[model samples]
Target chain A: MKRSNIAKLIIALLLAFAGYAAFFIAPDEATMHAIQRIFYFHASSGWAAMEGTAIVFFANIAYLRKRTPKWDWLAVSSVEVSLAFWSVVLVTGPIWAHPVWGVWWAWDWRLTLTLVLWILYVCYLILRGLIEDPERRAAASAIFGIFIFVGVPIDYLSIRIWRTQHPQPVLFGGGGMDPRMKAVFFFCSGVLTLLMIILICQRYRLEQLKYEAEELRIAIEERGEPQITQRAKVKV
Target chain B: MDAARAASIILRKEVRAEMRTRELLQTTVTFVVIVVVLFSFAFEPSAAEARRYGPGLLWIALLFAGSLMLNPSFAKEQANDTIYALRMAPVSAFSIYLGKMLANLLFLAITEAILLPVFAVLYNVSLWPVIGRLAIILLLGAFGLAVTGTVFSAVATQARMREMLLPLLVLPILIPLMIAAVEATDELLEASPVLDRTWLMVLVAFDIIYFAAAWMLSDYLLEE
Candidate 1:
């Protein structure tokens, strides 16, 4: 009944429709048939993950400039969400690769960059966990987030200059993709982006709630009411 | 005071302290020597094989040594709360970072200078032909390592599991530098040596970008 719930329901339906479109509406590839279908999900997730990184990059810079909790919250949420999508890309990549390339992994430029990006962000999370103070954590991780994002393009360039065996880009006028396949790919990408934004919103809300709970606990402690403090602690 | 003057003063202090107790340079050189020796034993490569693999091994050893040498850059500043004292000084924060990064670069370069002849003898690789070009690569690579290592050392020193934290935070970001350094070194160490301009450019670009990033972020980085 709520607006957000209604929106969620609509997105859920569209996601299912996207799945159906990817499987059936899109034409089969001439070479790889069913296995090639993974490309739709894999590429879309990669695009969404990249979008998430851009959000995180900007959010980190905003946090650094504004020194606000909301920007930090948005950053952490986007990072976790982007990491989830990247995991999907990494997983689906090898699944598609094993059969096609005769090997599951290659030191290709894109693949190596993806792995490095995942490691860098995972370290970001770990760094956040290590700092106990919330303010320090946000500031420190923002600095780190900006540092690592700056490295991403250089990492890609270095690896690309070293070697490249991954397939060429087909999405942006590079390859002769069927119009139906292109349409399905775009549909899937749009749905996935929507899903990512929704997930980030939900995660941001969770962080807000956690902040509120901490404030309440501190207030109760300041009041020196042990009994209600215990009750409040239990409720939290 | 100008940043360069403040940085020079801090650099003098760091160099003085190290000269009084040669701890980092001595330990790092010994550590890298052991690594080069152990690697030679581990691989026991023929002269031909060593020519192919020696550069990679040498860089890996230097990377480990640099990590070890860099760990105490900020950690030791905590022993007497000297970092806070440095912060309270009238100097800019970037001066502190620049001075410390320069100190680290100096230490790593010294360690590499000592280890090179040892590595050359053990690996049966001649360095006289490519020493000039190789020095350029080593300086650029070492500068990149020192900049990022000093920055991350500051970050890691504030965290739990500080020793384990530095490498995890730094190594991934240093991959491009590592790749470029190793590739350039490999080319120079080849039989018919010719310097590859591309990897050298990559090294230069990496150094400039990270150094500039550190300079820009120095204020935030040194804050409590």
Candidate 2:
């Protein structure tokens, strides 16, 4: 716990430093001026979402192969975190769009795909809720996670081939970023990735605690002996 | 048993059962027709607008029709516990998935064929001139829908609110398929109709990738 607290403290400091760099240090853009500052958070959230989904995909495959609860815990944690990241994307995306694109939302390729992806992952979460059994839930969600992950590439390719009003990916050579801007962007992305890891770890701990409580209840019910304490029963 | 043989056997069983009752097919055809008519009323497109938007409208209707038809692909097996019996069979789980996907594909194809002339008449579009190109596009688009819809239908069959869950799970995943289908259909319906190879290729790729993934994942999906 002490080690985790120290790590958390380090992440918090890094995040504070990244925020300072993005706002006060990075050079102003030629166009879109102050509004473009949202890009730092927006792009980092997008990267976090992408990385989270990738973790879900791999952990899901591992759960299927090993049938381990740890993998299921990891998978669900990643999904929840990923959903939060993409929610940031969806909300911040429009804020970035309205001032620049002159519309609150455009049915452009990238925006539409992201919106669809958000809905698709929401379906994944809802599917998890609808299942009653824990193992069955894990298995089913793993299968669905694989399906959703596979669809992401096709979603991206479809948008890439059929371009619309969504801006091109300027981060990667579309228009090269200034070196200082690149430093800030990478700094923000690194901080967000660290934050995603911390969130998943904390969420995984909650799932672990729940699992332990469930095991304790099962043990108590099976024992059915006279010595069990009332407090233990109530807690269980 | 070989996967192909197992798949063909399941396919034959479904076809025979479906043919005997014609229940799913009849309902789906009627549903598609009603959807097309409802859309015509809802949009009330002019000739010029109809030619531009009719293809998209047709695909939207087909998606709804396909969802209704695919919903019971596995749910009926649950009623008689036949799915358990099928699980005990020697066939691979992928064969079961393939069988259902083929069945759904055929059902959607037949409904689309019926809806096509009706749509042409109602919308006052000339489909006969580009019927060949249109058919290919429909086949690819419907195949993609069947591949994803059948898998998701199985996923939804276990859910409490299944009918609602299937479309919620399917439509978003199928945006690319819908986009490509609508675009290809739009191109085919233009005044000087020409098929867009790029969109057709997208449809084809989507179908291939999803079909392969479904085939690989069906075993996991069908677990008890």
* lDDT agreement with native, every candidate: 0.91, 0.88
Clashing pairs in 1: none
Specify the CAPRI tier of model 2.
medium
- Write candidate 1's Cα lDDT for B166-212 as tens digits: 88888888999999999999999877898999999999999999999
TM-score of chain A as modeled in candidate 2? 0.92
Question: What are the root-mean-square deviations of the candidates from the true structure over C-alphas?
Answer: 2.5, 2.8
**Candidate 2 wrong stretches, greater than 4 Å:** A223-236
Q: Which residue pairs in candidate 2 collide? A: none
- Which TM-score value belongs to model 2? 0.94
lDDT of 2 by residue, A1-236 (tens): 69989999999999999999989889998888888888999989999999998999999999999998899999999999999999999999999899898988988887887888889889999998887778888988888889888877788878867768877777876987778888999999999999999999999998887876777677678887633455446533
Expressed as tens digits, the lDDT of each residue in A17-58 for candidate 1 is 999999999999999999999999999999999999999999
Cα-based TM-score, every candidate: 0.96, 0.94
